[model samples]
Target: MKLHLKAALAAMLCTTMLAAAPLRADNEPAKAATKDTAAMAATAAKAPKSIDDANAWVVVGDVKGFIQKVGEVIGKVRPGTDTSQATTFLGVMLGNPTIGDLPAGSGVAMLILPNGDNIAFAELPEPKAEANAKPAGFALPSTRAEGLTIFGKTQASADAGKALAADVKAKLLGGKRTSSLHVTVPFGRILKEHDKDIRDGIADYIENVMKIQEAGRKMGQPPSVTTATARMLEGEFRVFHKLVSRIKTVEFDLDLTPDGIRTEALFIPEKPVAPKAAPGGQPTVSDAIKLISGQGAMRMAMEFNPEAITTFMEGDLMAVLTEMGLTKDDLGTALKWMKDWNACFGGAAAFDMFTPGSKAFGGQMIVRLRNPETALKMLESMPEMFKASGLTKLYEDMGAPVTIEFKKNAREIKGIPVHELRFNVQAGNVPNQLAASMKMWASGVYQIAAVDNWLLYLVGEGSMEEFIDAVKAKSNPGTAPLAAEKIFGAGGYFYTDYNIGAAMKMMQPALPDDPANAAAKAALQAMSDAMASAPPLLAAAFNDGGRHKVDVIVPLGFLEAVAAGAMKAAAAGNAKMDKAPATTSSATREKSPADQCAENLSKIDGAKEQWALDTSQKFGAEAKWDSLIGDDKYLKRMPVCPDGGVYTIGKVGEPPTCSIGKEKGHALKK
Candidate 1:
């Protein structure tokens, strides 16, 4: 009933016992993977929004007054390098995006601190105002911080101790103080600098990551973008604001206190957003997709299908594994993903990478950089622990291997980078099943940062078959390979159904497009991309770890099954070729009567006998060379013996040239 993707997948397998669809016999038809299909386009135009998103919190008008009181208490929480506040803020925002409605021309409140940490609150632009800020989930003021303890400060006595005179030292404890207080180092700096307490604070950041990591496991781990925001009131008109441009993770602990809504957020350091390309000649979606997923070699068969993909998640997922060639044991320590993945990717850009040779695999650092480059570079540089590791080796050592090919797909939306991408991912066979079962392998949009490259791609066998179908359907080529293949052929990583869900979540509150809302519309459009899942057949191959070429796309299972069938077919065929003739030629030879009579005739006629002997000798010598080697070499000069052998000798020191020896061969003694 819950549009869970896991359950729906059971009904739609990429491969089956359905009668094999025949290929077109006509001229080779060009296939195009355009996102122009009416069905797919509609879904992209209106991807599904969250079930409760409509009623979620909307912070419109100025709620600065309310936030200030809250900030006072939150500030007392010295979350120095701690992620608890980050998670709490992320969870609250995720549970609800609207925090009271407001009219136009207003801004969120903000402030900065000496330590570069701050709080931010919202006050929507003026004109429209709505009250009843129905804060949902565990309301902030109602709940308290989890495991909060008494925090105390230590007195600094180092400077005072040093400033004492020799006489005072003798009176106090017989120790001399030579330095003046002004010249001596300030004691407070030492107390705070690298203090055991300061390092201890890092636990907060760790705990936050752990919390969000747990939440990600609960949610789907789609590409979710997280920002650490400390919402608090600053002065009257403004709310102090500080946020990580990108958060790599998030989770909420509502059970500890059962009442406390504790959230953890792990944010990526903010960097300048990429500059978008200037407006150029506009292109159609098909053309853009074509440019991105060109030829079978490099094509970007993109679509934005949410409903079709959501059908895959259903039932208790362990049942799904029986079909996918996995067992309960495969899940390892992460038996419950509903709670973990939900929290991980239930936000902006929930990202999971299936790259070959990158550190993104292996450990669970979950580094969600501002952009893909930062994430890539971090892994690229982390191998310094070894004697030597360059970018190439780093890629080789990763859990999931990846090689990306970029193509210009979409026009830069308001000068932001929107390139199409295809990653040569080395994933297992039938990845969708694994995605449902394997926590480590599954990736959602929540962890994702903006992908600069890799729009269209191909992976393992027969993947391109599905893309070819989508392209052919949209482009409506005269010929198509197979109806099944047409729907899902080419394989590579594209947005998952859950990912589309996340995409729609971020794309929520689609602004009304009008003359006055031109800027807002631009912002909305800039953030949105019309993406869809690659056909199931194609998607399965990359997941299946099989080879895929355009029309020839095949799932690993399909290929293996076909190979076994072919081997049987070939074995049957070999039995038919073994029935040929054994030999050839039908001629006979007779001995001359004169030869038979020669023995007796030799006594009577010497001259005639001598002539016959000379003729026989000449005939035998000429036939000897032709009978043995067919051709003569220098070794042919050797004399022939009566014994059916010819003898030629060469020194052992000199390389003995090949020659037929004139002797009955006998086994040589070792």
Candidate 2:
């Protein structure tokens, strides 16, 4: 799974540098043969490789190479624009700290197949060989004849196109007519060339952040949820990496269709893999599950294969845990507890969220214990098990207590006997002042009921009663989305379709109404109008033949609208230029709020001395106002406006007159 992060990282790098089009495999044939079929076939005969036989092929470019090319173009179009900053930034983000740790030239190709996968054959520069010396990493190559390619022959036409091409070849391609990293790899070969040092460096950065969080907590500031989650995940990743290391092989398949792309990822364990069968498999969910009609604009359902998960956990997973220092008795006890829990309630669970602004939500969970009595006993033990794990400490730290309460009172829904279970979670740790000021309303009756082998939870009166009546009336169509069922069956599915326009309208009142932001609001309205006709965003993940697949579909119309708007804005700028307005000096340019404040402050009596004293309290006594204002003598000091004038520090409209009348405008508030 971590290896798969290459796609995301590579995409981010590519998008950050340049908006390049998705790369297509050079030797891959088009879906359907056309007039160029014979030519393509001829080319394929001579080509050294072909993507036709591969399950998946990905073509990625080199970041440094792209940067070099961009630098050359910018140098030609806008001379004196230094591109070293871009190169330095990329190096800062991705460079390995070790000397000579640079990637070779551009281009990477990956192919996946059923038997063996061929991933990442990154090209490298020439090796530095020395016996008894440590192995070194890649580094950018150097070339001479700097101006040879840029300067053409005297007889040659000095046309703009020819001149530009020659310049690009010279500056971007290192004076070489052709470039190559001399990298190629076939199937069944693993590169194993990634920079583990870079990975470790990132982990170290996370550790530093955790230390910062610890310091903040000591300073009386509560740790934010994001910070806490990051700290927890950092710890969890160690154990996760240990387990993932056991998997020796992984593969993927991608199919491109007219509507969307379908993808599958498969992970194969090392030899002596875990067994797949439990001691005695329980009744399968095929005949036990009762399909119920789904409600709301969004629905989620998860079907677990208890037998498979248990077998794996009891077998190789247990072996790995033991090797990691866990005792057999402890591992066995944990496995037994899991098996007992699964036996009671594990086959499937489903939840739903209604349309935006609707509070309706409900779900059904399978609980197939030996009998209703045993199921109730198991339910009663859940809170004890959770608290024993010390998980409640997490909630307490977040200012919420974990709650568990059950009732023996019973009823029947859809021929199944039902019992009730309820829990309460504090909305969150919030300041009372904020809640009161915002007029926030937060209260609800959250109900949970068990019916035979099913446990149902509901929120909102209409949704709860509707679900109960639907089950009794045998009108439920089950939890899976109608369309997704055809692909993933009942495994685990999620579906959502809501009116974007309506949702935006519902949220409009939460926005600020100040006229100063009217232009921004108009732009947002334009975007909303553009999205009104767009299809809802949809995503789903499923398990197929030991492979995990995820699909996401988003309409292109929304993107098209935004792109069109950008082009329109650019054109308007060009039209304004043609309208004949004289260029203005920097002094005449509109000043930002901060700039205006600085200008007004510079006009006050003893401005420099006062600013130094005031800023010293915040930025230390050595801080100088002149240093921040820059070397331009005329505006060298920060502007300070007198107190109580129309031009208050943060006030807007026209520039305020500075006075020596009042001590600095009542110190600005945070």
Candidate 3:
């Protein structure tokens, strides 16, 4: 065996031992054992002899059964598709020495004491002589032999796990012996037990790794890229750690059904945390869900804890800005702007996407707000804030210079004030194709409207009028809200529904029309048709008292359709490869005179655009060759036309032209 593999196995053994034993006190293993035993006895006495008595538990159901079901489903979905090899591979992998000893429907139960110590009990199959023998080069520590027990190797060990498995099946599995897997963790208890240690670790990282003390240096002296990045990471870690600490326990379950697999996760908090009340005490999450329920191919609604999120953002943003060499006073305006923007939003928001009779999709977001006026004011003052805070220069230093502009009250829809936000990115030192893509992305116009204490935002290739009209129709009384769907009957604080069939249908036209993709396209069409009547995939996260539950449902038909499509696509790809034509070598291809001229024209056009942006020149503004083409300018040197044609540097907005006529292919394509 390789050294790394041996080390990994040794580490796994150490972890298992540690889980079996209690945390030692000053190296006194005997005292730790005694204390742990007493604590466990007390806990067991207080609670009934049930799976809930354990701090955590993991249960895995019949593996062979699940594989068999999947194979059957695939065969029915696509008759010609072969899946025997895949199932055989899975069987061989699962039958390895490391885990092959474990019986089907095995489980582990863990009991964590208040002092952060834990003991685990696992059920195992009757050990086979060959499987029980440790692999060569893997060794266990003799000193911890007493802490590790191989269940089912002895009558006593076998008896120890029998009761545990019975309790788990009776209580946690609800007497259902189906093929499924489950894991539960008491996160809050663990965090509480090691609160001081966790906090100290975070502080140490911030001080040592982030070098936070250097943040107080004189303003305008930027920290090194490494230090700045470390500070940002520390900030994010702090926020995430805080969030996780609040979670009491997390439980995950995956169940195999006749149709497909279903997975669920539940997050329980130490205490209930509800969204802030919307203005006029309206129910924001539910109302928003109702408004966009049956309108689009995909829909989402969520409610947030505004106070907690705002606090996290304030700390994170301030730390990052200070690390970037900004003083407290310099950040005040930006911080205030952020706070005002945050205050304007209520805790709830809804979003949806739909195809608008074209190849592209469109989306709209509606957010409940306490005051739309405040949001409008914030938008109006954003440009000045960026300028005053030296953000433009900061971005330029970071190599992502951008121009931000806003047009307030650009238009009104149903008497609501609509605004437009635009961004222009000046990409530096990148391929022409990537630069063009960045330009297109930066050119997108984000439209927003203030609609009676609610904000409506529109995006994508659809017209603003079309988006607005669609939203209005969905909001009408006659339309059914998404919550009415049977799959979403159990409403949640966050809910999302995806109509996969509809989305695939919309995307079909965007697929390539070449012969290589013909088979794949046909398969996609068949899958979409088969799933047309299937229920949409639904995911919902809601708080049930102290527990937060997230449930996701994927219909069996959808899964079968996807499997069939993938198999067909794979076959098509193989067939294409078998008949593929000989490839052309790039070294053998020479550029024609016209092609060379066209390339030169492209370079000149890019340089001209960059120069215009740097000089704040508008459309039709005159551009000079000296300002654009030089060693120190946007271009290293003026590109010479191989066809010996003179180049014309046009105005700021127009493309550069070649004296060589279009008939000779010297001009830019499209």
**Residues forming the 10-long window of minimal summed lDDT in candidate 2:** 149-158
Q: What is the C-alpha RMSD, rounded to one decimal, of candidate 1? A: 36.8
Cα lDDT over the full model 3? 0.58
TM-score versus the correct structure, for each prediction: 0.18, 0.47, 0.58
Most accurate candidate by TM-score: 3
lDDT of 1 by residue, 1-670 (tens): 2122212221211111111211211232212334433343344223113211111111112222223323332333222222223323422332222323322223221111111111122222221123124245322211101111100010111121122222222332122221110011122322332233322323333333333333223333322211111001111102011121122222111111111111211122223232223135422223324221221211222222222223323332444445334565654333333222222221111112222222222110111122355334333332231213122233333223334443442334333433333334443432232323333322221111132222222232222333334333433232223222234343322322112212322332333322323444443333232222212122211222221112222233333333343444444434433332222111101323222222112212222222223222221112222222312422222332222332222211111112222132211110
> What is the descending lDDT order?
3, 2, 1
lDDT head-to-head 1 vs 2, winner: 2
Judged by lDDT against the true structure, how good is candidate 2?
0.41
Of candidate 3, the 10-residue stretch with the lowest lDDT total is 139-148
Per-residue C-alpha lDDT of model 3 across residues 516-627, encoded as one tens digit per residue: 4555567677666666665678788866655778878776777766765566656655565556554422321366878777777777877876675445454466889888
| Residue-by-residue lDDT tens digits, candidate 2, 115-141 | 222222223233234311422321111
Model 2, residue 659: distance off in Å is 22
